[model samples]
Target: MLRALRTAALGMSAQQTSVDNTANNLANANTTGFKRATVVFQDLLYQSVQRGGEGDQRPAAMQLGSGSAIVATQRTFLQGSLMQTGNSLDLAVNGEGFLQARRPDGSVVYTRDGAFTLDADGRIVTQSGLALEPDLEVPPETQEIQISSDGVVRVRLQNEPDALEIGRIEVAQFSNPAGLRSIGANLYEQTEASGEPQIGPPAEGGAGLLQQGFLETSNVDVVQEMVDLITAQRAYEMNSKMITTSEEMLQIANSMKR
Candidate 1:
């Protein structure tokens, strides 16, 4: 009964974590370039009761698992659907890769978001003012800007007959993208597990091509998340029932001793 109680308690705890992960996914269903996460669990160590005996023809050892635990929360990197905004500055990636941006402290971060705009200094930057890596600068008197599929930036100066090439956008990749650390505002930093970033132009080395006037929508599927939420709720209830039954069994045993 005691073992049953402990196992049931652990089960309930693990289910709670599942519920939390599902909730987060649903919450960010509409967030741009958002990726959902899933919970991973593992059974705890087993307790041996009896060893096998060859002479006695015993089949195998008797054992019982102590419990289960949430081992990790893994982020799913499946591509999200692209949305068309038709805005000149909006950008979207069509395949694998991330855009590199520099924070205020000069630390670099990678993101899937490409909704960019020009800052006060005519520098292309994210909404939070983080400048794009490689530092693309548009002329103050530019009338139109264009980004090629290979990430080449060009602009047409006011009253100019031809467009002039400005700079190229760099895309970064990782060996294990899920290992990157999330620091909010749809930004992620490289980690040891993720390996060093591979910087290059788009449409090269598995990096995605850039799409102007478009943005990537969150990958979360509301219907699937709802189903997961229901499953987790049912599992939690079952674990609670197991704990109750274990307690009742203990109570009955104590009454018999009277």
Candidate 2:
């Protein structure tokens, strides 16, 4: 009965983690460049009840699982739908890649949110003021900014009929993007599991092409998340019932008359 109580409690805890992950996904359903994460569960260590003899015809062992645990939360990197914003500064990656941004601490991070804007100094930066990697700077008197599908940045200055090339936007790819750590604000840091970033120009070397005037929407599906939430709730309830029944069984055993 005690083992049952502990196992049911662990099951409840695992279900709670699942619910939390589903809630986060639902909350970010409308966030730009947001990816939905799914909870991964693993069975806990098993306790052996009987070990069969070497020459016995029966099974080698009889075991009972302790419970389940939340092993990892994996983010789905599937491409989100692209929404056209008509703002030249807004960008979207049409394939597999992430834009590099320089954080406040001078360390580089990866992101899929390309809703960039020119800061006071005419430097293209994210909403958090983090400058894009490679440092694209526009002239003060520039009339128009144009970004090509190949990540080329060109600007037309005042009274200048010709467009001048400024700089190029580059994207990075990882062997395992799901291994990247989320630091909020649409930024991800590479870890050992993610491997080193492969920085290159967009539309070349397996990198994704850039789309100006567009932004990638979150990949969360509301209906799916709702289903997962319901499933988690049901599992949690079942575990709670199991714990209650185990307690009742213990009480009955203790109340026996001799």
Candidate 3:
């Protein structure tokens, strides 16, 4: 009965973690460049109840698992739908890759959120003011800014008849993007599991092309998360019932001793 109680409690705890992950996915359903995460569970260690003797005809051993535990939360890196913003500075990756941005701490981080804006000095920056890598600064008297599908940046001066090329945007890819660490605000830091980032021009070397005037929407599926939430809730209830039954069995056992 004690073992049953412990196992059921662990089951409940695992279900709670699953529910929490699902709730986070649902909450970020509309967030820009957000990715949905799934909870991974692993069966706990098992203990042998009986061991067969040498030359015996019986099975090798009889084992019982302690319970289960939450192993890891994996983020899905599937490309999200692009939303047209027509804001000129807004950008979106058409396929696989992440835009590089320099954080306030001078460290480079990766992100899929392309809702960029010009900073005080006309440098392209993220909503949080992180300047885009290989920084491209716009001239104060520029009349128009144009970004090509291949990442070529051009701007026309206030009184110029032809546009002048300013710079090009670059993207980075990793061997295992899901292994990257999420530090919130839609930013991800590279980890050893993710391997080194492969920096290159957009649309080349398997990097995604840049789309101006658009942003990537969150990849979360509301219907799927709702189903997961229901499943987690049901599992939690079943574990609770198991714990209750185990307690009742213990109580009956105690009464018999009276």
Each candidate structure's count of clashing pairs: 0, 0, 0
- Model 1 TM-score, all chains together: 0.96
lDDT of 1 by residue, 162-209 (tens): 999999998999999999999988999999999999999999999889
Compared with the true structure, what per-residue lDDT tens digits does model 3 show for residues 1-258? 899999999999999999999999999999999999999999999997776664575657788889999999999988899999999999999999999999878899999999888989999999999999979999999999999998899999988999999999999999999899999988999999999999999999998899999999999989999999999999999999999999999999999978
Candidate 2 lDDT (Cα, 0 to 1): 0.94
Cα misplacement distance, residue 21 of candidate 3 (Å)? 0.7
Q: Candidate 3: minimum summed lDDT over ten consecutive residues — where? A: 50-59
Clashing pairs in 2: none
Q: List the global CA lDDT of all models.
A: 0.92, 0.94, 0.93
* Least well predicted 10-residue stretch by lDDT in candidate 1: 48-57
What ranges in model 1 sit over 4 Å off? 53-55
Q: What is the TM-score of each candidate against the true structure?
A: 0.96, 0.97, 0.97
Q: What digit string (tens of lDDT, one per residue) describes model 2 on residues 54-104?
A: 457565778889999999999999999999999989999999999999987
Provide the lowest-lDDT 10-residue window in model 2: 51-60
